[model samples]
Target: MKILLDFVPLVLFFIAYKLYGIYAGTAVLMGATVVQMAIIYFMDKKLSAMHKATLALILIFGALTLILKDDRFIKWKPTVLYAAMAVALAVALWGFGKNFLKMMLGNQITLPENVWVRLNTIWVVYCLFMAAINGYVAAYYSTDAWASFKLWGYVFPLAFIIGQGFYVARHIVDDTDKPAEPPGDVQ
Candidate 1:
């Protein structure tokens, strides 16, 4: 549900571009971004956390693209946002002594610290790849193709992540040295 909210603007942008034009879609995404941020601020705990900063950037640059009436600007937004997120994740992992990935997803599965770092690196590299892919599509592909990719390209990665979660969960060591499982429920 929350993931869909994060994706709403991109979806809208794509649809608008298909029906109207780049500028029109940009306008729609801009409005959606404002709404997204408002939800992030007001509904942090109840709904979803605020990791849509990259999406917000997309919206802003989309607006700039509309106002400037240049497709290049809008095309650049995703690349910049993706690269920026990659850097931010790397910094959080190593330099800032933070573990954002863990915060976002650790509790559900457990793994070694090294695995976490490697996964973190994978995430950064993945973002970079995403940026490049977006650029390629925007520059060479038709708007319809770009929008289709935008809508569907997310599935493989999401499925990969979910599978990795299961793999990691299977390997977790119950090293707390207590009962094999938490209290309550059937034996």
Candidate 2:
């Protein structure tokens, strides 16, 4: 359900682009994003920082695309978002000595400190790679080509997530396997 909600705006944008054009598609994207956020807020009763940032970027860039009559803004939005994520992850881990990925997920799963560090590093690198690829496509490709890439580019994230899941699964501890402690009153 959450994943479907997350993809609604992108799917709508692609459909709108196919029927109308960039400008109309931008408008649809912006509206769909707003609706998506509202539903999420109602469901969760709050929004994560990432959710807020994504909403803001979509509205800002989508508006610019429509108002300025430039498809470049929409095309470049993903690059900007991904680059910012990379910078934030890197700075939080190195400059501040904080592992944000761990902070966010530590409650749900426990892993060795070393594994946490490696995961954070992997996230930073992955974000940078995504940003670079999106930047390359947005810079060098036609609008139609970029649109197609936008829809198909989901493959990268899906693969990365499945791979990450496999990696993390190996490290997850199963408490059920531990032996029970002896009673304190044992003779």
Candidate 3:
């Protein structure tokens, strides 16, 4: 359900684009994003920083595309977003000696500090790669091609996540795997 909610805006944008055009798609995307966020807020009672950032970018870039009558603004949004994420993660991890991935998910999943660092590093690299690829397609390709890529590019993240899941699973600590305390000898 949450995944579907997250994707509603993108699917709507694509359908709108196919039925109308980029401008219409942008408008629909903006509206759908707002609706999506509203629903998420209602359900979760809070929004993640990522959600807020994504909403802001969609609205800002969508408005720019509509107002200027140029599709470039909308097309470049993903590149800007991915690049921003990569820079944020890299600077936080290397410059400030912070692991943001661990900060966000530490409570939910336990892993060794080294694993957290490696995960954060992987995220930074992945974001940069995604940013570069999107920028390349957006810059060098036609709008139609770019739109198609936007839809098909879902594969990259899906694969990345599945691979990450398998990697993380190997490192996940299972309480059941630990030796039980003998009788009442709790330590």
Candidate 4:
């Protein structure tokens, strides 16, 4: 279920683009985003891990991009969101010496403070890199090309990241009642 949910963004975008070019797909993507948000909103009481607000914001901005019929909006959406996230993570680590990421996934795994800090930095930079890569493909490639990359380009890297994260978590997990460290925070 988590894996499928992870692919929601790319899956919806691809289906949208295939059914209706960029414009129509943009609208469909926006609509689907709203539906996803609605699901989270209604399920919040039942589901503990869902992020409703993020889904809502995505739908809102995605809809605006579609209604305005400007490709730039869709293109910039992920770029800005991701880049801003990277900067925020970097700032948090540098200024506060806190590990926000650990907070998010700390319950699931145990890690040390220093390790969490390093992982946070790496993941944040990775997101920024993804944002840059998204922008580059959108600019140089066709819509189909970009859409395909969005759906497929991430598969291997994501697989690696998850595998690595789990591996690290399992290794660092303490058996006794030790305090958890922060993780690399992400949306």
Q: Quick one: best lDDT, which candidate? A: 3
**Model 2: per-residue Cα lDDT over 104-144, one tens digit each:** 89988888888899999999999999999999999999999
Model 1: how far residue 77 lies from native, Å: 1.8
Give each model a TM-score: 0.74, 0.92, 0.93, 0.78
User: Model 2, which residues run further than 4 Å from truth?
Assistant: 175-187
Deviation from native of the Cα of residue 156 in model 1, angstroms: 4.0
- What lDDT does candidate 1 reach at residue 82? 79
lDDT of 3 by residue, 66-133 (tens): 99999999999999999999999999999999988999899989888899999999999999999999
Which residues of candidate 4, in runs, are more than 4 Å off? 41-57, 177-187
Q: Where is the poorest 10-residue window by lDDT in model 3?
A: 1-10
Clashing pairs in 4: 101-183, 101-184, 101-185, 102-182, 102-183
In model 3, how large is the Cα lDDT of residue 73? 99
User: Model 1 segments beyond 4 Å from truth?
Assistant: 45-52, 92-98, 103-110, 171-187
Residue pairs that clash (backbone atoms under 3 angstroms), model 1: none
Q: Candidate 3: misplaced stretches above 4 Å?
A: 175-187
Arranged by lDDT with the best first, the candidates are: 3, 2, 1, 4
lDDT of 1 by residue, 84-157 (tens): 87888989988997877777777866667777777788788888888888889888987667668877877855
Better of 2 and 3 by lDDT: 3
Full ranking by TM-score: 3, 2, 4, 1
lDDT of 4 by residue, 1-187 (tens): 6456556756877887888787777776776666665665576544333244345556666767777877766766666667867777788788887666877778877777777887887878787887898889878887778778777887755775886667576658665766677888878
